[model samples]
Target: MYTLAVCAEMVFRDLPIEERARRLHDAGFQVEIWDWTRHDLAALERTGAVFSSMTGYIRGSLTDEDDAAELLRTAEESVKAAALLGCPRLNLHGTGLDGRGLPVDPVAGEATGPMWIAAHRTLGRVAELGESAGVVFTLENLNTAVDHPGVPFAKAADTLALVAAVNRPGLKMNLDLYHAQIGEGNLIELVRRAHGLGLIGEIQVADVPGRCEPGTGEIAYPAVARALADLGYDGTVAMEAWASGDDDLALDRFRTAFTV
Candidate 1:
């Protein structure tokens, strides 16, 4: 059996977070807090989506620096927020090293060494802080080639490296298949590899190319599901897809993919 959560932004708009949680309950899906700005602990208590996790980092209102100390402070606050809301997980990323639009020559230690070092230091602090707060920090991959090209961890291997460098139990990888399929196409193989290494903390899915509902595109989700089951992966498989109309189509697609 696969537990499903929908990215909050994908299913619900900028309405009150409590109303969004109510709608998620009505739709029979858990809410994955994609937009942290809209989070409400009271709403979480009412909706029971507290068991769910989020995607992005806590922004300006949350933290204001890129150094290790700042990262630790931010992680502490995020854990406090999660615990206050009864959330157990908070998905995070290695930002700030994103060149934005600058040209980098790898030969000049341009984008690789500095970015990796910063990620290692910052996320290491996050790991330490999260450990004390009992909240897991899941680092996700971004599709840097086409979408979000400036992000540092744009591939699966890069995310894995960061986690390894942090070398903490509280820090884990968030393997969202949508980004994986687009950025690293060996879906089943990579899942198997991550499982083999005991690194994957969570997994998510959606069709590639367009990040739409499953079964509407080219990803072999059934095979991926089989691989996950084979690895005894019983974690939440959140849906991070776009819904042009009714999200029932998206839900149906997941039902087909997971066969639940």
Candidate 2:
């Protein structure tokens, strides 16, 4: 069975981060978060929620040499925080994103040849760090069309290419279906290809039109869930979505969508 988790940062807006995590825990879901640097790790640990993943870098970009150094340094720090939270996976992007989900230094379009080479080199070092720290680092896909514009390698195909090229167990792709829908539709095949290549680390979901829980928008999530089950993907299927109305109801809808 797929282990269902929820991003605490997206739901239960009325509560504190720890409280949000606790609520998810009590509701029978694992928790996910972003930017561990901004949160009180100890307080979150006290909530007794099982953390599935969190943002893996504080400040770094894979675009240049100096930025890559910063990325590796902060990634090392992030590993420590992940250990404290007992989180098994850490999430990364092509560049460091600001609080608003915009890349700090956004790229205009597709990556150049040199940029691709640098990203591959930088991710090799990141894999070594993850290997040493006993955690997996996942590069998540983003939809430049909506939430994250100007972020290079924001497509699932690009992310899969990078992870598959590196071909290390320590590194894998965070196959986010919500972004894939906007950036590239045909999600069932996307999941098939990514998992078929043994490159996926996690799967995140939210509805299109609105970044809310399943059933509120166009995605036939139950079909996606059936596809996952058919593929024997027993990994995490997470709700990285906001509450359409009531938080608990949204969670229920998410659970229903993936309960194949």
Tens digits of per-residue lDDT for model 1 on 1-260? 55677776665556666776767667777767764544656656776553578643443111223444554555566776676667777887544222242212112212466666766767776777678778778888767665565555657888887787787978889888888888879888888887787777778777877777788789989888887877788777888787655666667777678863
lDDT of 1 at 84: 64
- Candidate 2, 140-159: lDDT as tens digits: 99999999999989998899
lDDT, candidate 1, equals 0.68
lDDT score for residue 222 of model 1:
85
Q: What are the lDDT scores of the predictions, listed in order? A: 0.68, 0.95
The backbone clash count of each candidate, in order, is 0, 0
Error of 1 at 111 (Å): 3.3
